[model samples]
Target: MSSTAEEKTVMKVAEEEVINESRRNFLKSMAFLSAVFAFSGILGIVRALGPIQMKIPEWPRIKVANIKDLKEKEPIIFNYPLENTPNILVKLGKRVTNGVGPDEDIVAYSQICQHLGCMVRFMPAGSSSEFPDRNLFYCPCHAGFYDADDGAKILAGPPLYPLPPVKLEYDSSTGDIYAVGMGPPVIFGKGPPGSTEVWRDLVGGKLVGGG
Candidate 1:
């Protein structure tokens, strides 16, 4: 082959290689930009969602009842850290779960059912032959119930956790009953059912009337 023809052939190959290299570089640049944009899009979505605003409350100890004032099997409705969040305080005439005072029969629990936020009412022993036991916290909404004598354990129906019991403080000196804190599995609608974040119970509502 002629030397000139040979040089031309070499130049043509070099040009083709240069074009291939440029193509590869262009594809790499495009891929990098796509990844960067995808990550930015995810960040934008997170920003759009915003942060969850929670009200971290100072758990209050509010005096709710006087032992002498309580009547057996009667319920006194009151609010604790949050207004509108009703709790039932009762004296079952016998010792019970978290019961306070001399008889150990005084107890308190959230009125909200763990199943669906239905208010629970105290059903006295023998009040309903249909119920397996007395000293019951019953939810009429779905027929679900709790055993008041036993930490308000869910006895039947669809409740996921025990009725959230109110932590009680008995003043032997004053015969006063105070609601000190809420138990595990925070109240329904505040957080998720079975959530142990009791503080969430204090988040949504106004503090009990005077507290």
Candidate 2:
């Protein structure tokens, strides 16, 4: 073989080897990038699945008022857990009357609007100015309304569920009002069972009818 031909052959072999090396490096880079992206995707999913920590204050026993203070069809507003936490105590009777004793007429509920955490107020209904014919709860912020008697049922408005009713037990002996437990939070914008919504907006999403 001629020397010049040999040189040309060697050069051709070297060029092919360089091309092969470049291809291998590119493939390695692609593999590394793919692995990094896959790992990042898994981490993102883990973060999404992690538990959300809420900073709700410990439940405290709220002294609503003297049992005798509330009148029929009238409501009282108070705070619990902290001064900032608002609650509503209502006295329901067949007719407007005073004095609280062991009777089915006295009831209390939390005033915090189940939808978006707005404050709720008692709305009076009647032709007479002295006493309201009927009592209802109204949330001015989002027009959420709840029935006063029995459980606070969602009467009308954007709220999908009723206000959360706080469990009340009055000590007949002491005449001190005590809150035993709290009902599940009201959930808005969702139907019955399993669909998720914002916690601050609503509770368990179960709608219980008023008595």
Candidate 3:
């Protein structure tokens, strides 16, 4: 073969290799750019959909009544912490030594049902012929019944759980009955401490007449 032909052949092979290297570098660069853009888009989406923190304030305490207001075998409805939250305060007649009463104690419970978030009402023992002849917390929505002494139990209606109990304290000096805290707020029915605008409205007294 001629040296000129040999050189031309070598030059042609070297040119083809350079072109292939350029194509490979172009493809790699495009791939790197695409990956970077995709990663940035993912981060943006995550930032947009991040979990929101609820800012519930500490539970407030409110005076409901004086010790003299509650009577034996009677239940009174009142709002605690906030007026939107309903509560039931009961005064059990004198405590019974065995089964009779003469020195009973006072108790209070949140009226929100645990099963499906229904309001509970106090049903008098003899007022309703359909119900048993004992005082009980009754849920009219689903016929859920709870013991008056405690809250609702697992034995009633669609509500397989008991009602939430509020912490009640009586002021010795003033004889003022106050609710200090709540057991747990209803999840779906009521908004958490500071999660939504609804809570702010409640705090500002736009919904319940006054905050």
Candidate 4:
């Protein structure tokens, strides 16, 4: 073959390789620019929407019963925070925690059972063979028992935790009994997102109010 023909062939191969390289680079740049534009559009949309406002649930002051209406060892059922949430108020007939009025015997607890989310009731002394000497709160389902005097401590059955106490406020002037807030354990199944809020409260080792 002629030297001129050989030179032409080599030049042609090099030119072809260069053209392919340029085409690949152009495609890569186009892809990178497209990703950058898409990202910018998403950011712009987010900025235009402004900051998101989350609505955190706050505890409400619910009227349960008047101070005169209560009797010793009797429990009054009422809803707190919402209409669906059940709680119980009991007149212990003596000073308990921050109990008010002349005797300071009033106390309250969440009716929702800690064991399996069952409704619990007040069991006065002698009502149950278990803890006959003391008053108690008893869950019929799975027999979750809590000591009524000691902040609803777990006494028996599958409940590993105490029942959440209901914070009460007594207006002596008006005779109004108000359900102020929740205490500890997070009230059974009701919790934020992953339902692990109770775990955090438990780890903190104190009675945390539902905020």
Write the residue-wise lDDT of candidate 2 on 1-211 in tens digits: 9999999999999999999999999999999999999999999998999977765333445557677777766777765433445677776664222223477566666677877778888876662243355567788898777777537777778876676665666778777786644555533333333233224332322222110
How do the residues 134-185 of candidate 1 rate in per-residue lDDT, one tens digit apiece?
6799999999879998899988889988988889999999999998888888
| Candidate 1 ranges beyond 4 A from true positions | 1-55, 209-211
Compute each candidate's TM-score over C-alphas: 0.75, 0.56, 0.58, 0.65
Q: What would the TM-score be for candidate 1 when compared with the true structure?
A: 0.75
Provide the clashing-pair count of each candidate structure: 1, 3, 9, 1
User: TM-score: which is higher, 1 or 2?
Assistant: 1
**Model 4 C-alpha lDDT per residue in residues 50-77, reported as the tens digit of each score:** 9896544445676778988988998898
Pairs in clash, predicted candidate 1: 83-206
Whole-model Cα lDDT of every candidate shown, in order: 0.85, 0.64, 0.65, 0.77
Write out the backbone clash pairs for model 3: 56-193, 56-194, 94-102, 94-103, 94-104, 95-102, 95-103, 95-104, 96-100
Clashing pairs in 4: 94-105
Q: Which ten residues in a row have the lowest lDDT in candidate 4?
A: 200-209
Stretches of candidate 4 exceeding 4 Å from the true structure: 1-53, 192-211
